[model samples]
Target: MKYTSYFFIFILLVAGCSDSELEPDQSIYGYEYFPLATGTYQVFEVTQTDYLNTGEVVTSDFQIRHEIAESFVSDEQETFIINRFTRANENDDWEYLNTWQSRRTEFNAIVSEENLSLLKLVFPIEAGVSWNGNSFNSLEEDTYVLDSLSFPFRLNDQGFENTITVIQADNQDFIVSLDTRFEIYAKDIGLVYKEIVNLNYCADENCLGQEIVETGIEYRQALLEYGAL
Candidate 1:
């Protein structure tokens, strides 16, 4: 009888341990991090800066709106949320730009933009989790490493309760020969901030002569407002 009782206690302990791990945190739901319901939308202030080989610098600032237009199912039965992108100057009307699509599965969330569908986030967000966020794009080899899954973040003077910050770069040092981008998302809100730095410079292998001329781009977008419908 003692042996049987010990066996039962062992089984109870094992069950309890696993149940704790399996239970969802209920605090960091995937949907809260990136809500995709129809009528959800966000507005951003965008700044574009460019450097020319002629030593000329050009900078422009504008506003953009991203709104969830609708939902559709693919041939494979996967559903996606369509976001309409529109842009305008400070005092001008918004001009339709393009549409982007994104969807979330049990394992990860994927967003299609700039003609490529790429993984954006993974479930059970925790620090140190890494993934190739730009695998679909062939322009440059890139990877996104999550620095803090629950980073404390503030936007528009409002503090977020939960935020995820991902650093997208070509190398581990947060630097690449081509470009690097940073994206931050908040709970129940989509991307709240983004910054992309692109560099285009040509030089010889030995780093001698003709390396004087270079061109590049710097872009930033910060969320100004958002709403969920």
Candidate 2:
């Protein structure tokens, strides 16, 4: 085995010892998958802010990601990455990857004795998204505070919040440029709707409209729902 791997284990062992070590940072995890164990699974992240100008509802592409194996090491004792995330969007009701290359969504685990995943929204970490420089052992060290992602104006409300902080970049250069208050998401679930905040990059004051409508996004479009908001 890789010596670095052994070093990784030592890190976890000294990290801590607890029962809730593998718990998710977000409650949404339970609504989707509770009692999560070591295995591969999928989650849908969704969000719906508002068109500051027209109060129009704009949706984002869904991310399909897998949570591979969960393990406890000597120092860190955490989960490992088996697969990265892929972004998807449906064209003519067909789901396709937003990119032709490896566009995986990854996340950092909450570094704590409890190891609870408290925040799983978009801007914070772009729920269901993977990141560079982040690895299986990221949680064993850093505090996992995502600090830079723009909030989509079309998807905001007066209660706009930033659950995840992101510095979004893809294989190519294409962007919608939503202000910095971007909300983290879960596929099919639509807006984590729990943690919201205004980011410094907030470009628009009218993030979401006061005149909110249900839009009835769910139950009507299971495809979109499953596709992730």
Candidate 3:
């Protein structure tokens, strides 16, 4: 009798533990962070040319550090901004793109509807190759991307060339704070010229006057471009 009673109690405990009367699981959404990368093509551009320090482009490796989106407000007013920088130099070490701690920007779905076919610079924007033997991109051509920050993206021509307007869907809105160029690999495309792009959105007469903002890009070429091998 005692043995039977003990066995019955064990089964009851196991069944109770598996019942919904136990504890519930909990989870939280993880946010991401991104910062603009230092100018490397600039190194390539000024190759053999005098720059901040070295007289020539000996090693392509450099350092890049800046603040990222520490957090975000899950609303339509998606905003992001960074104010510190130092791009391998002496004079412009800790300066903003032009000024320090300058004003940032905000964004909606439709960034700019203006004649954006201009102002915006194109990556592989050279239309030609660089001194190091970069090639001119072809239609539907593909190359190894070194960077891929799609922050300042304008979906015109599917990102083939610059000077194209960005079009978004009806229901969905944009979620970036900077109005700069979205980062990506210029594979078969061209040189990475524009780091930040300003989107000018002016729809109609009422909303037609003038409203512009900045957006930064974030891409991982090390992974996407297959780094080296």
Candidate 4:
């Protein structure tokens, strides 16, 4: 009889362990960093600087807005339509610029801009994790790394309690070229800042490492306001 009782207890313990192992993880995966909802919109202050090979520089300032205009099902997942609008200044009327698409999967988030698909972020956000940003596109493979996670970031006098930084590319050769691109996303606010600097420096022997930008573009975007329309 004691042997039978011991066997029953062993069976119960095994079943309990199996049940626990089968339970799914209910923890958050940091998807809130790129929240998507119809009518949600974010406006940004944009600055574009063009470096001419003739040694002339041109700069322009404007405002851009991205709104989740609509959504549809694609590939068995919900995809959001992003409407982009631009204006020369806060007092100017917004003009329709273009349309973009965004979607989130169980493992990653994707954004399609100008018909080019880009993997923006991965699930279970963790600092130091990296992935190929051009996995879904035909462009050359580029590694994207999560440089920071759940960190505080302040922009335009507004403070964000949780933010993440994704480093897309950071390469430079003082004598010939420079390429640096990164984006910052704030929890519940979406992308707050973006910067892209790609330039070619003078390669002459005397101008080596002189950092004279020749022909490239410097683009910056900072969040101005955001809300559900």
Candidate 5:
């Protein structure tokens, strides 16, 4: 009787361990950070500032909408077609602007805009992980880093429960130029915010190291609304 009881206990223990091992990990791989579905759309408020060589500053404000129009199979991989529309204000009608493509693989998420393929994010999201953003394109190597992971962020009057930021480039020469670019994506939503600041600072003897802007462009896009159509 004693031997039988011991054998039963051992069998139970082994079975319990096996069951635990078979359970899947609940860890979030962050694939939902850039969820894609047909009819899904996001609207953004875009602000562009151009600093011309003649010291003229031009600023423009508009609204742009990105909709996942359809999906197609390419080379045995699925690709999404995103239609972009723009309007000057809330009262204006949206006009077709351009078309872009996006796709996700087991390892990375890629976006092709203006015929430039950029590796936007890598899977198994973790802060500080870096990859070459231009790996799929002919552009020079551009290192993109996961600057921040899973954090709460607020933009305009909206708030996001979880968001991640990708720092595409953050290089600056205090005496000559500055080029900083970053994009933020929210959980269950795509890109929430993007900013690009490429400016040339005055390098004259009087303004050297003073960080005075000479020329370049500053562009920003902030999410205004998002939902599935």
Candidate 6:
């Protein structure tokens, strides 16, 4: 066997170390999976279903868009990323909606909208990992669990890609109510689809035993397009 030169061995070692050094830049890696930079935008198609007390169910569909409007650091030394969200029906002009802000700490990514603040995502994503996302919500506590470690999910026929889907309230009491949510995120992209179904029902005077009469609402939001600017 021929002996290798010290210069060649040193060059190979430097190349390997250069790649390993990238792990220290947390921001870059995190942002690649969930971009929060300014000018990034994503559009979604929303479908809503509402059940009235009169045994009537109404369904509506619309489009919603969220844009990263601004990014700044507060005096508390926390970086806040602002997002402008809007929605409209088909062939209709987009109406301005409210704004929201998000920031990431060492453990979690939090989003604050209106008077509500909650955990949106947990860092170091892995399969079987779970967290209490609704700890900050005054209304109720919710646990967000990762169902798929690496899944091939298709969105709007956009072709299958590696993705992860986190589910909240996966188990439901169908006899009384259903408050379930599923959020799917694609690698190197943001939220691809979100489905929230809130249905609370009661029995009517003429209904059978445990039969549902009045229902609440169901909402579904799916990604239409995404871009980074």
RMSD of every prediction: 5.0, 16.1, 18.7, 3.1, 3.5, 5.0
TM agreement with the true structure for every prediction: 0.75, 0.26, 0.20, 0.89, 0.88, 0.80
Tell me the deviation in Å of residue 99 in model 5.
Answer: 0.4
Q: Per-residue CA lDDT of candidate 6, range 1-229, in tens?
A: 2355877887787887866585677753344445567778888898899999788899988888787867787765455555555556657776777777777666677788766887777877777788888766786777888888567887667864677788876757766676788888777777888898877757454553463737787888888888874
Task: Candidate 5: give the clashing pairs.
Answer: none
lDDT measured at residue 201 in model 5 versus the true structure, 0 to 100: 95
Global Cα lDDT for candidate 3: 0.27
Tell me the deviation in Å of residue 207 in model 1: 9.9
Error of 3 at 40 (Å): 19
- Per-residue lDDT of model 2, residues 47-108, tens digit only: 43433434455655454443444444444444443343445543233343321111112322
Show pairs that collide, candidate 1. Answer: 32-188
For model 4, residues 126-194, the per-residue Cα lDDT tens digits are: 899999999989989899999998899988799999999999999976678998999999988889999
Better of 1 and 4 by TM-score: 4
Which lDDT value does model 2 have at 66?
39
Number of the predicted model whose TM-score against the real structure is largest: 4
Query: Could you tell which candidate, 3 or 5, scores higher by lDDT?
Result: 5
- Candidate 2 segments whose C-alpha is farther than 4 A from its true place: 1-34, 45-59, 70-72, 90-229
Candidate order by TM-score, decreasing, is 4, 5, 6, 1, 2, 3
lDDT of 4 at 22: 76
lDDT of each: 0.76, 0.33, 0.27, 0.92, 0.92, 0.74
